[model samples]
Target: RGGCMGQCWYTAVDTQLYLIAPLLIVPLHYFKDLGKAWLYIMTLTSLIIPGAITNRSLSDHERLYVNETYSTPWCRANSWIVGIWTGYIIFKTGNQLKLKKWQVVVGWTTAFATGWMVMLGMYNVNEHEATTTYIIYEACHRAAWAACLGWVAIACHNGYGGIVNGFLSHPVWQPVSRLTYGLYLISLEVQDDLVKYSRKNLFYFTTLNM
Candidate 1:
């Protein structure tokens, strides 16, 4: 359980971000363009700091250190800031996104492409030889992932999502969504305990098992 408590760190990080969200959100609400500029600056800063730290501390042969790059609040802020940006846009538009047909087509195309790029772009890469490339990915990938999700959210909210919206917004998901927090809290510990106390070897691994 002690080792499995790593999953719980996100709750603490999320709470810290929620505590400070008003600092960013209030200005964006009241100041318009100036606040947007601040957000853009903050977004860029968030992207840079993680890469800078990785480059400074990690050798060219080393992978990113999880504690520094993955678990830190500042390193994880890029996605949170992107979410805030998406929410701000939705608020301003009154949840009515009106784009031309061509624009909608292009937005969905680009969103899917970006999502795939983030998902598969690292495959078979030689990280030890291309540490700089890994550093750049480390800095940008979370924000890119968030931006893709943001597009999905925007499109679904405004009926541009077609079948995607139908699947995501289906009533069947409501009860499952309610259990996600409890699942998140206990699933890791259960898995850890099963492995720790098992008397026999676990079943063979496969994608299905995963």
Candidate 2:
């Protein structure tokens, strides 16, 4: 049932993570270094769990996509934990991250490299086959993607984002951001109904058409 909602599985996973957030957040607020260490451990564990599951049970790409690897909170916690870590860092630093020019350049470079790898590394992998490399990629990809996002958020908040921040923080996005939740909730069902009742076959596919 968790993964059966078409695109809405994200909502379920997010809610599950939200319910357990305080377990990390409360200690993080009160315990300082201990809380940071706990978050780091959890992040490492998040990576390990998916790798272990993939190695032990997932035999193919399709199986990996359909199985708990794609849906379960434990398997999906890498990004969530990364986000928490990012938030904690922001809070601890009072939203002021001062870095050298070289540090900023290195951070941006690393983030972009990780983001690209996560996006394109699977292009050559056989969809019907699984391997140790795929398992490692699957395990690290989500965390890497989240790390990229976390870096953007941190950099933007700290004024290091430059034009990227200008684009992202534009007022034009405010209304769209507000409507995103409603759009996400109904867009799939609306599309399904449109296809079901259409007079002609809906064959043409493109981002704008969809």
Candidate 3:
């Protein structure tokens, strides 16, 4: 771990095959049983052993090796699975859902609130965090985020997003959105350096740089 701590060449195991695994794992035929697959994937990824593996803090050795071997697809696959299913649903259902205005508003609002709570690290805010809760949160956070975005996508596709769709689809965001894939693949190096040697003044650092 020390040998390659700051080297960009030493890619994390989680990055291994990540660019291609989902392309292979999620099949178009699987969409034929979308509901069943959705339920199974959600339950396995959220309640099974693999879901809890990364929740525990890893030792240096473990971080360098074990995480690569055991945590990659198992721990992260739920997010992809849910996303695939959601896209299928949106494509198949289109505007046929015909949800009421209030329904869309309430559904998206609730999903957004739940996603925010999880994404903001609210579950670990306390000095004494519960292991059980953390495990559940770790397992479910990705699915929760995916679900929230799925709701937004559904609304946008079905013409129910109202203002949200207009804002998100604004032309000003097109260029930035195009860089999303590149950002996801490369930002870790820059972020790693900042976090690894940070001076501990988060507020000042964020204000100055972010």
RMSD value for candidate 1: 6.1
Q: Write model 3 residue lDDT over 1-210, tens digit each, in one string.
A: 333343332245346536654553464446556645655655464445444464545334255334442345555566766676687777678778788778977998898798878778654446674656655666677778888888888888888887999999999999999998677666778798798888675355566587
Residue 13 of model 2 has an lDDT of 85
CA lDDT, every model vs. true structure: 0.87, 0.87, 0.65
Better of 2 and 3 by lDDT: 2
* Backbone clashes counted, model 1: 0
**Which stretches of model 1 miss by more than 4 angstroms?**
1-4, 60-64, 190-210
Residue pairs in collision within model 1: none
Clash count of each predicted structure: 0, 0, 0
Worst 10 residues of 2 by lDDT: 58-67
Instruction: Give the winner by TM-score.
Output: 1
- Indicate whether candidate 2 or candidate 3 has the larger TM-score: 2
Worst 10 residues of 3 by lDDT: 1-10
